[model samples]
Target: MTAEPALRLVDAAHPAASAEGVAPAREQERPETAGAQTLRRGLAVLRLLTRVGPGGLRMGEIGHRLGLNKTTAIRLTRTLVDEGFVLHDRAAGRYRLGPEAFAVGLAAEPSYELQRQAAGMLRALAAESGDTVFFTVLHGHESICLSRDEGDFPIRNQLIKPGDRWPLGVGAGSCAILAALPDDVVADVLARNAALRAEKFPRCTDASVLSLVRDTRERGYCLQPGMVFEDSWAIGVVVYDANEAPVASISIAALRSRLGPARSAMLGNRLMQASKELTAQLKA
Candidate 1:
């Protein structure tokens, strides 16, 4: 038995292979199959529609944005349209998410029930603060605006809207969520999101964001001091789950003049209260 060992094949170029002829634990990923590629492209189209809101995008624009040829885009979109996931507006020559899309989204609504729970609170906070209030949720390493409410303030910070997405820590609510994370996890998040943040949000350096995190922890809230836009300012607090894990954030955006030191602190307190109430509601 010691004299006869079974033959094993190993790729010489694979560095992970052992000297004793053991195979490597990992292999290079194979290319996606045609069917898989087509499915991925279709999903990309759907995601694009979600980001663009109700107006929708023209076929040509979709192709251009996705870097697909006209024929390929047309074929993919036509297939989706036939499947009822997308609808084509004959008059406008644009494609929008169809009833089937809404039906599908409804199936996943339970995961986003927080939006429903926070709707009244967001509106109330907006009215009380006389500014725009936003409810944002952590989606992977990014933050997405799930709902927005506007107050009677003549001036509005229109920089963000529902369906908008940003790298974690780029905005007030987002910063609050990031700040709530454990230090080691925050480091990981920053490392993973660094490239995207640099490409999309040049102003959000790691040092600056870490400073904001420290300040957020000290003050019990986050203050985005006109970083994204010179005139736009916001205050935010993190909402936690039953286990005290950060899940989302509530923020108020106003003009820089409206968010001076005194008012910023006051609004931050209000947001913290809302965060606590929302967290309790989710637990209940």
Candidate 2:
């Protein structure tokens, strides 16, 4: 205990325990937990709102769509509003997409090169078929128009601009996409859409909607006569990715009078070929 002859010091020593007066050893940071994962859920909510279009969803609708409770939906919306990702309209008691979201969307557009590359193919298909062609991708439970080309026909279906949302089981484009989804996902989308349709278009029932989905899958495409617009017919083919997953849909819209058996067959062939070509381009 008495300093034992002053223990001899050795020049050979370990590295300093501190670097620049800061401890080198510190606790490792942990990955995100459940609460942190909620951030992603919030972002998903914002995306769903945008997909729903300018007339954003109400609290209850958002909750129903996301499988969250009303309280959770309100809380999430409040957070989004605070962050300027969504704007609540007090007068209309509805929500609209905020400016900040638009800024982000504008920035992200070019990153999705598929839309740009598919535009040329869409135009060529339109010119060849003389029928209005639409390129749409799935967003949440809706199909969003990403690009379109007008036909040379004297009378054609009006163009659906980018960002326009349509219910997943309503028209040929939506049905084609939905049919390609997993069975459970298709059922869930149809069930949710059935409730929405009852509120919006009461004439369309769940059975009819399911029938359309089945027919689309059976035929490898969707053909809807006057489902979306009066006197308009649409034929849709699914555009697949390298994994054979349906990533988008290519639809031809024409006047009902011009969609006879022969015309329908020709349009179907053209749409199928264009969709295959576009899918190949996406793969490349």
Candidate 3:
């Protein structure tokens, strides 16, 4: 065969062969593959660490909460530590989030902007209402307090603060997000966290959960009057993200004596206004 003639023939037949530099599109992801499963479990570990706060969790506790066996949890945590996604304390035998995980969270440029917006709004609301205003974000079935601003209230709520977390229906901001969820999602969350509520928060009942959802939808905001504790109350509104999802909430919590019907209405209006302003900024 003549080499030059064969080359010409092949190029003619496959004219785009020289354009092989162009990359093909990535394949669509499937649900149940091993890689997907591993990613899910790894993310679960990170989320667990995030919820456990600075104290972190022991390997045994991590396994118990995640339902992983000792050997499997060891392998999973080792991989996370190797990748800098987790930090293992040799002396304490506790596992916590590492710097790399914070790097990943900080890279969420939009959440930074969201926090800025929230900080200003929280400060304003706390000042205007003379109550403690909290910034909370939804994490799975719970809400984590990202930040809070305290007003000059003579008595402040000792309930929620930065780094504290509660189940969805437990706190004002948490219930705000929970109530803003679509009906089915609200129901699912209630069902999913029923056991947790019964164990940790014995006061919250299914009837009350339904009532909060109903009242929030009807009233167009969230109110948890003495739900978490007697002589304590809170009101909130959900703040939507750019995706128009209820990713977080802002609320004002106060002593019941300070947040009666008249004061509640006044603070509720302020809280809703702040929520709207923050939502607009975030979705922008």
Candidate 4:
């Protein structure tokens, strides 16, 4: 006989062998450990720098916030400087975010352009709907108001200035964009925001907020009645880029009484149309 097959020989040696036995062995014994603590320290430094605005930060301050020794913080800062993510000022003895960081930022600059192009559309929509219109973008698990157009109505929702950040799932504009995010990104954002949600948005439950997100994806818009403010309703549509990823959202806030079923439906349609037009214009 030629010989018994390899599977047969192996099975003969181990009678109870299964298909799993025939599979290739894992390349590595176990997953490699990551330098997560170091990563966290680095991120903490970046956040502290951001909080200090563009003025840069002294080494002592960065060390104090991170609970790191000055030498340790200096080592980390040196790594960041080498990678082009941060820069150190020799005379001032301070560190600031550098050009490499800005390069990564440029990739996300489309959202800012989108906001600029949507300004006029938002204004027209606000004028037509008699409600405040807001253009918002998702930034590090929060939604930031990038621009706004106030309606003619004297009594309206409180104005939100550009750069003001809101929890991702708190308002319609944010929820709409979060709902349209890639599934994995949504999960990551939710995981990262669990504590924040508990602190700033005690009224919102994970299940209810996720349900709203699912419904937003299905309905092509998000409508929240009294979620952000009492006696007011916020409605929003996701603003997509050429690649179809959600880059921003446009929201309309109106009095709950005026946003009856019929009026709400009308406003939703207008908001969606305006969002589409702006997306097209921005891409152009």
Candidate 5:
């Protein structure tokens, strides 16, 4: 989500698994050749379209970003259009990601299953807590929202929607995943996102984040106040994969007054239980 590919997993015995049992990547490197270079460039174009959000990008912007000349950009995009991986807007001259791209995304197995399984958990949690609930996968060094359900509470604290991306440690759900990551991964993510956090996440310093990680390790959840959306407080728990690796998180957000210490503990326990349920469902 942070300019990195989303994480998609398959079943333990999925065909793509190696002897070590990992899914084959959606994007694979091809031998270096003129044709392979063209294919990589075309894929890069599609990736860029995905990052630019729904409105997409103009040919000129795409060309400039990819360091391609206008002619080369046109040629590459023309091929993508013909192949249905890209959509061409005749009137606006913008190129957007097409249904083929979406189809390919849907082809990933476990992500859809996770989506289906987590939806009911999120709804049940939200209904019980009277707050907004979100489920996000740790995609690369970022957390991407997959789904959200609002509770009966009218004063909803909505900061992100499905498909929203934030650097790991940027939000409650993101921080929960970051805090629950292996120590090495936590260190690596902190180092990679250090400059970005300093520039953008003033509230979450290196020392503070490390403390949160320690807290999560000890207590099994993360509690952050006013780190993401202002005046919104949140508590979260991480969901692990079949191998017990942190893959995603489930979190609740609400007004500060609504999430008093007692209520926070109650909702935090609720989220932890739901996280367990989802973890088991994902593994299945």
Candidate 6:
């Protein structure tokens, strides 16, 4: 066949052919599959339970806080209870973490070595300072309160308990972790946590957090002067890993009246010393 006739025949046979063909459409338009969403919601319920302490939460409160519908919350909690990750207190009309949850947490002990190592330090700090001491670890753009020790102080700052999660720049220990990071990392963390900070921690703007980072770097510790709660003040010092990277922090929280400038500085230095000891232990 002549070149023109051959070309015409090829075009007729493959009229839709192109150098850049249309990309295939996605098979699943949703961000997550139904099964994945159910699993995520289930985990969310479990995390929420961790934060509420022994009191647990009512079904309506859980549904309200998580934005889960009444039926969905019921189903998820029922499944978790059936699986032994949760327990329904029929008499109290509430749900709390069950034995399986503790088992799972215990199984993950290796991941919480810092928490284990810092427990003694936390107790000593709390005893010496007559204040509440907390151990927090960095997790993504947030920080998790791994443990806490209470002092004999008459009035304690009970704002942050174990299992509480905060954006990196919100709490004293979290701010210490964020401040120990490089400037670029600090910026990225602020950007990622901006929305949550605005909604939950309105006072912790990027600018304000940067200011705190500068101050922490200068002082070798963080003094959270009633940022989270006007009457609650705290001091924090970062603990470094063997490679000298910041991994976790120790913090002391008390009433603002108790944390005067001199006392704040003293506590900050004390925390720094405790952090150094922990860092040495981790290095060993």
Best candidate (score: lDDT): 1
Model 4 C-alpha lDDT per residue in residues 1-284, reported as the tens digit of each score: 12211311112234344221111111112333457667866866765565455789888988986689988899888899899889999899899998987897789787477776777788888888877788888676877776767676756565355555776777789889889877888787777776656654554557767888988887788888765455667888888886777878899877778788788777888888887887677567
**Better structure of 1 and 2 per TM-score:** 1
Q: How high is each candidate's TM-score?
A: 0.82, 0.63, 0.65, 0.61, 0.69, 0.82
State the lDDT of candidate 6 residue by residue for 1-284, as single tens digits.
11111111012234344122111111122588899999988988998888777889999999998899999999999999999999999999999999999999889989988788888878988899988888988888778778878787766555666676777898788899999898899988888777766755566778888888899999999988766666677899888987899988899988788899999998888888888888899889
Q: 141 in model 2: Cα distance from truth in Å?
A: 1.1
> Weakest 10 consecutive residues, lDDT, candidate 3?
1-10
The global Cα lDDT (0 to 1) of model 3 is: 0.74
Q: Identify the runs in model 6 with alpha carbons over 4 angstroms from their true place.
A: 1-34, 54-61, 64-67, 89-94
Which residue window of length 10 is worst by lDDT in model 2? Answer: 18-27
Alpha carbon lDDT of each predicted model:
0.81, 0.72, 0.74, 0.72, 0.75, 0.80
| Count of steric clashes across candidates, in order | 0, 0, 0, 0, 0, 0
**lDDT (tens digit, per residue) of candidate 2 on 233-284:** 7899888876788878999888788888888877877787877887788778
Model 5, span 17-95: residue lDDT tens: 3121111122124369998888888977986787667788898999998899999999999899999989998888799
* C-alpha RMSD of each candidate structure in angstroms: 16.6, 23.9, 20.9, 19.6, 10.7, 19.9
Quantify how close model 2 is to the true structure by its C-alpha RMSD in Å.
23.9
Clashing residue pairs, candidate 4? none
Clashes of 2: 0
lDDT of 1 by residue, 180-255 (tens): 9999989988887776566555667799899999999999999999665556788989999878989899999887
Point out where model 4 deviates above 4 Å: 1-111
Clashing pairs in 1: none
Q: TM-score of the candidate numbered 2?
A: 0.63
Scored against the true structure, residue 227 in model 5 reaches a CA lDDT of: 63
Count of clashing pairs, candidate 3 = 0
List the candidate 3 regions with Cα displacement exceeding 4 Å. Answer: 1-105, 108-112
